[model samples]
Each structure stands twice: as C-alpha cells, then as structure tokens.
Target: MGETIGYARVSTSGQKIETQALRLQEHGCSKVFQETYTGGSTTGRKALLGLLEYVREGDSVVVTKLDRLARSAMDLGQIASTLEDKKVDLVVLDQKIDTSSPAGKLMFNLIGAFAEFERDLIRERVQEGVNKAKEKGVQFGRKAKLTKQQLESLRNDFAEGELSKGQLAEKYGLSRSSVYRLVKSEH
Candidate 1:
C-alpha cells in the first residue's frame, strides 16, 4: 500500500472546504488538495490535475463524494481511466466506492452508466418539450426589432432614395447591417 491522497472542492469561494478536509483527514489521507471550482467541467481545475499527476502506483485517491471529483459521468470515467492507468485506487466516502476491490470497480461503472442515462433522458425530455411548444406556434429567439408599420414606412423611405442606408438605420435605431438586411429582404 502507498500514500492516501485526498481531493476536496467547492463550487464557489463562499463555500468552506474545511468539512471535506476534515473528513479526508479522518479517512487517513496524508495529503489533501482543496480548491473552489465550478462543477460544470474538468477544465481549469488545477488542484485536480495536480492530484492526478502526484499519485503513483499503489496510491489511493480519496474524495468525500463522486460529484466533488467530477461534473459528469464522462468526466468521472476519464478520471477513473487515468487513475487506473497509474495503478492508483479511488475511494469515494459518500458513495462507499473503493476501486481497490472487484465489487467496488463494478459499482463505480454502474453508477457512471446510470448518471449518463439520466443526462440523456433529461436531454430527450427537453427536446420533446421544445418540439411541443413549436407545434403550438410558440416563437423562439429574439422578437422582431421593428413593427410591421415601422417596416413599411422604412421600406417606403428607402424606395424614395432620399436618405442613405446609414441615415435610415440611425432614424430607426438599428444597425447599418440591419438596414441592409431589411431593404434586401423585400426583393
């Protein structure tokens, strides 16, 4: 057996990492890496990257929760793979996951699969909701900048060639590109 390392993270600076650090100490972690990072992705997590690089064969990496270690199933899988490659074990206290045993490995894989499945279900449901809204004639994106009357008047002004496109855009509080698009759209 090698050294036991711990990693703890909170999403924002306001949150305290002392609780996680205490738990890791109780779990026999000799060194603990702590950071405040958003759990959206593994990017910009220097502590995590350092912990991964620091561990060696026979070493164990411990965390209070699987979520504290990774943002998504894919991220967890990648981190797990890296640890596996380094011949290091992962111990997640809250989930009771210990990758030093066969059963723990199985449990970790199962949990990752379930998390990915849940995300996929959520994405599908959201798409269905969006499609239903579209069917019911719900418009999306930004509303038109100009009203129909305003558009007609602008078109009439452009046809008379009295004002330049820039002048028309200024009058309507629109960009020059918007004016060009509006005038070109008629043809």
Candidate 2:
C-alpha cells in the first residue's frame, strides 16, 4: 500500500487551500500536493499530475470537492476514471464521494448526471431567451450602414448619374465599395 496523498485546488489567488489541505491530512493523508488556477481544459495541473505519479495500488487521493478537480462533467469523469485505473482511489470530502465504495460509485454517476443536466438546461434557457427577444421585435443581425430603403434610394441616384461612386460614399458616409455595390445592384 502506498501513502495516502492529498490534492487541493483553488481557482484564484484570493482563495486558500489550507482548509482542504488540513482536512485531507486529518483524514490520514501522509503527503499533500496543491495548486491554484482556473480549471476546465487544463492538461497542466502540476500538483494533480504529481500526485497521480506518486500513487500506487491502495494509495488514496483526497480532494475538497469534485468541482475543485474539474470544471465540467467530462473532465471530472476522465480524471476520476484515470485515478481509478491507477489503482488510486479518489475521496471528495465535500461531495461525500469515495470511489472505492459502491455508494461512492453511485454518487459519482449522480454528480455527473446533474452537472450535464445543468449545462443542458442553461443552454436551452439561453436559446429560449434569444427566441423570445426575436419575437419581441429584437434585431438578430449586425447593425447596417444603410437600411434597405436608403440603399435603394442610393442605387436609384447612382443609376441616374446624380451620384458617382466616390461622391455617393462621401455624401452618405459609406465606403467606396459600398457605393459601388449600390450602383451594381441598380444595374
């Protein structure tokens, strides 16, 4: 059996890992490795990598929470399963999950489910909000330099030779390319 190790993470400099470290040590962790950084797509959590390398069969790795280990369900799943493959058990104290037990396994699945569901719900809500805005006459495109009516008027003026491309651009606060586009559209 290898020594029990601790892994703690803080997303920002203002937060402290001392509480998590102390708890892990209290839970019989012999050595603790910790780091502070925003996480999600991090393939470079140095302390976590170090802990993984330090462990052997029967070695335990403790964390404060699953979210501290990963920002998303997929990332959490990968890291948790990797630890399991290494014969390293992960104990997330705050989540009350210990991957070495059947109950813990159930909890892991539930956490993953909830996390995925939350993200999906948020995405759906955002789309619904945008749809509602559109229904309420909100514009869904980039601001136009000239409206349809203004563009048509410009095209008519250019066709009648009342406005040259460069002259139209200067007069209408449009680019030469835009004036040319209007003239071409008229033709």
Candidate 3:
C-alpha cells in the first residue's frame, strides 16, 4: 500500500480551496496540495508540479474534479500518462475515474472525448453569437483609452511641434506609442 495524495486548485485569490481540501481529506488523502492560480497553462502550477514530483510508486493522486487537475483533454492525458509512468494512480472523485483499472481508463478516454466535443460546440455557439452581434453593429473589446478630442489635440500638438512625443504622452497620461499613433492618424 502507498500514500494517497490530493490536489486542489482555485483560479483566483477570491476563491477558497478549503472545501476541496476538506473533501480530499475526508476521502482519505494523506497529503493534500492546494493552490490559488489560473489553470490556463501548466507552466506556473507549482503546487501541482510538487505533488507530481513527490508521488512515488503505488501512490494515488486524487482530485475533487477532473477539470481541477488539467485545463484540456490533452493536458489531462499527459498528466495521466506521467502518473502511469510513475506507477501512481489517478482518482477523480466527481468523475469516478480511477486509472488503477482497465474500465477506468476506458471511461477516462470516453469522458475526454465528450469534453472536447462539448468545448467545440461551445466555441461554435460563441462564434455564431459574435457574428450576429457584429451584424447588429455591436462593438467588442475595450474602448479606446484616448477620446476623439484628445486625439485631435494630440494631432495639433504634433503638427505645431510644441512638445516631444514623450512630453505629450506624459501630459495626456498616454503611452508614447499611443501618442505617436494619434499624431500619425489622418484628422
């Protein structure tokens, strides 16, 4: 028999990992690693990396949910492969996936496929909504930081050559690149 390890993650500082930790503990996790950070990429997941490194043969890595461990199906596959290579088991409580058995592996693959399908459907729906919004004359993304009057003033200032680009940027609380763009644009 080996130790049972648990991992918990919350995307932002505002969210708490206590509930996850408690669940893992109740589920017989001898050790739990918790972190608050975005799972957008695995590059900066220190706690997860630590747990992976610390696990040994016969150990089990547990999570409250499958999504809590990896951002994408590919990521989950890689992590599962690593755990398998290390002779460690993966247990996702919510999904009831325990990679210690043949049936579990089959279920995991099926669930991954379904998750990818769901994501593709969501992306298609979002694109359709965005296209419809564009047809209705809706705008997206952040509004320009500089106002039309400020842009015009910057154009005049640049034409008069009263202030340098840096000075103008400082005066208007804008970046030098923004000032340059405003000055260069046709009035």
Per-residue alpha-carbon lDDT of model 1 for 40-154, expressed as tens digits?
6888999999999999999999999877888588898999999999999999999999999999999988887777677678879999999999999999999999999999989
Q: Is candidate 1 or candidate 2 better by TM-score?
A: 1
For every model shown, what is its TM-score relative to the native structure? Answer: 0.68, 0.61, 0.87
Strongest candidate by lDDT: 1
TM-score of candidate 3 relative to the true fold:
0.87
Superposing every Cα of model 2 onto the true structure, what RMSD results?
6.7
- As for lDDT, the candidate ahead, 2 or 3, is 3
The worst-scoring run of ten residues by lDDT in candidate 1 lies at 111-120
Clash statistics: count for each candidate: 0, 0, 0
lDDT (C-alpha) at residue 32 in model 3: 99
Candidate structures ordered by lDDT, highest first: 1, 3, 2
* Per-residue lDDT of candidate 2, residues 1-187 (tens digit): 7678888889888998898889989988889898987775548888877777788888888887777777677877887788888888888888889888999988987886687677679879999999999999999888978888888788778878966678889988999987886667633
lDDT of 1 at 132: 100
